[model samples]
Target: MKKTLLVFGLLLAVNYMFSQGCSDAGICSINHGFQSEDKSFKSTLELAAIYSLGEADVGYFSPYISYTKRFSERFSFTSKVTYSTAHGSFGTRSQFGDAFLIGNYTFKEKNKKQWSTLLGFKFPFTASNLKINGYSLPLDYQSSLGTIDLFLGTNLHYKYWDFNGALQLPIVNLNNNSYFKEYGGTNDFPSTNLFERKPDALLRATYSLKTPNKKFTFKPNVLFIYHLGKDSFENIFGQRENIKGSDGLTINGNIITSYSLTKQSSLELSLATPFVVRDSRPDGLTRSFVLGLQYQYSF
Candidate 1:
């Protein structure tokens, strides 16, 4: 009975790691301890590929690259870029997505407790207005959300656990051109004209574990995101109407596993899925599941 229980516990941990996907805007991946304290390298570069299935059978593929530079023991900066391609029943579209620039500063450190603060910006590449044959596409089809956002967050770490909180606020709204009314009965789409998205508040907690041999690391995490206000859309009369059931909470679970290849290189896999979703997700951020593979090298 003891041996059987041990096997069952191991299996459970592995299964829960792949339960959900990671799409918490940009807060979840920052400050994940990619830098090595024992090594002299102060910079790291990462390349990643991600795949996810979205609403209406839409499939998305994104390629990502990021560079992190540690200026000091307590301060660092990261820059990231991504390109995305999406296809579904409506059509196919591809473009450069958003970019993120973040800075982190460690404020307090004790025996086993540490605290850090982060400030970041998300910039869009386009006007969030993609079209097909003169008709505007929905949010799901556009590669960029086309909104400038500011992120204010902080992190607390104690022993093998971490807690994070952040707020993502749209400073500028450039997503006003998505008009999905002209699908011509062939496709039943949501109303997303001149879409206005609200702010998002997030909270997350995670636990990290390492193998006895120190070659593999497992981190299981849960995330909560709450839409702060109702989203709105422009109608035919140029009046903005609030989208019903747009503000609510979404819960997601994720597991990240990494294998150390060398002193300065590693491979990581991340899987995520939603445990609970809101009523309306017209922003097209809904994903049935997300899988990501990443490679990192430090110098």
Candidate 2:
């Protein structure tokens, strides 16, 4: 089993795999580009449910809602809120994932090409507590990192293809308050522990097409990522589970389809899976499949 540190002070110290099930390193569940400047404002609400499993674990279920609004020809804003419930050999825990927000601006355009940059942040908000079985759960199992992070992103487009990337860097470092607690005042730990995390980055590209009849649109995406590592709590005997290999490379592919139910309503579905992996993943953290569905309307 390879070991490494997590980023929330590593991605929360988070990956939803949109991404928690698929990328987890903070790549969007759905790539929303610096779309063509059009409407004065547009809103999208997406509901996504995804599942994943590793070699040693059985499964995780994460359901979430995301909203985006384009305020003008060059600016847009987006946010995502999620709840994750994990099951299998590790037991069960349902907690709120962090809330992520982004503000994007398109700064350049030429013919059919456009470029934009973004700034983003994540907040520590949980729907449930972090500790389970009287000890702090590992980073992957918890939702919020209990700190704030900053994001920088850029997007470039040509014809029907989009190239985009982002960097997630934590400006604050703090650990769980319930990281570990002692029994009846034995060799003790605190209700809260302090930990440090780093940054994670992603690069992605895609090509899209529409049916001649204007009834359906399809997009295929490719994403690559490298997340930094760190060390955390020791085992029951106070041995830092420091095994190393927390950082690595991952390649993913996804196909997205949309069908219009009307002028203002539509149905969307997608499938994303990682087909390539290199280097040791921390604690057997392998790639899994993610399927999603979303309903959208605009006013």
Candidate 3:
């Protein structure tokens, strides 16, 4: 009975993590480019939790918050913060935090079909004290590379359809060299020369239909992502190897329904699924199903 209860609890936690943002490869990207009219401030909050079943039991939970303000008809600014936790059956756990700043500019005139461009930077600040499968990994082992991301994207909005696309470039990387040397089992510590670069590109499109009363709407969206570059690993004993691979691509789709509760409040539910995956890295997991709920308020 005790074992059964523990299993049930773990399942619940995994489910929560899945909802929060567990990709099959353990990477999470939060998309929040949906926009609003000018001269308005919008805020949104979301939460997701997940669990991994089978021989290897793992669970994760993540919570995120975002705020955006439109300064003029053609410009806007956004800020976001997120926290995440991960746990494994062997009693290992890890946590991380991320923040982002974004600026958007419109190239077309107001009330006309136009294109908007977005530029952004992401800062990953992480601290973890967790064992990996009972092995005492250093606190820095679980940290991200602390990268600076350069974003360039354009959004096209028409009466019934919308399209968005972006490319992500990593301009700077800051990681503890000793951590990679120890874990990767090489003596290449303190040499930043062995570092590599990775980049990503994304494209998304959506179609929407509004109800007669204009209080409810249905939207279907499709997203495509491609990953490029190489990751290097070295051992404390001075052995080194570079993992080189071609770009990987994935396609996903989502259906979302939104209902207006009042003039300034709305509720939204979204269901998403992975449609196509190609050239997946052996060590990475692909995203499966995703469900999300969001609440937005304007003041």
The prediction achieving the highest lDDT against the true structure is 1
Query: For residues 245-275, what per-residue lDDT tens digits would candidate 1 score against the true structure?
Result: 7788888777788999999999999877777
Model 1 residue runs over 4 Å out of place are: 1-23, 28-39, 182-188
Shift in Å, residue 233, candidate 3:
2.7
Local distance difference test, each candidate: 0.77, 0.61, 0.54
Cα deviation of 255, candidate 1, in Å: 0.4
lDDT of 2 by residue, 107-168 (tens): 76789878888888877675223666775554445555555778888888888888998887
> Global CA lDDT of candidate 1, please?
0.77
TM-score of each: 0.89, 0.76, 0.71
Residue pair clashes in candidate 1: 20-272, 20-273, 21-272, 21-273
Residue 223: error of model 3 in Å? 1.3
lDDT at 190, model 3: 22
Compose the digit string of candidate 3's lDDT tens values, residues 1-299: 34643554455345434432212211224345546442544433333333222112333354557777777777777777655554443354455555777788877656868787888887767422234655533222333344566777778888877788888777776533334423434332222223443677787887777888989887767678777655554554566655544246666656678888877778877765555554423222333445557777666
Comparing candidate 1 with candidate 2, which one achieves the higher lDDT? 1
Candidate 2 has an lDDT of 0.61
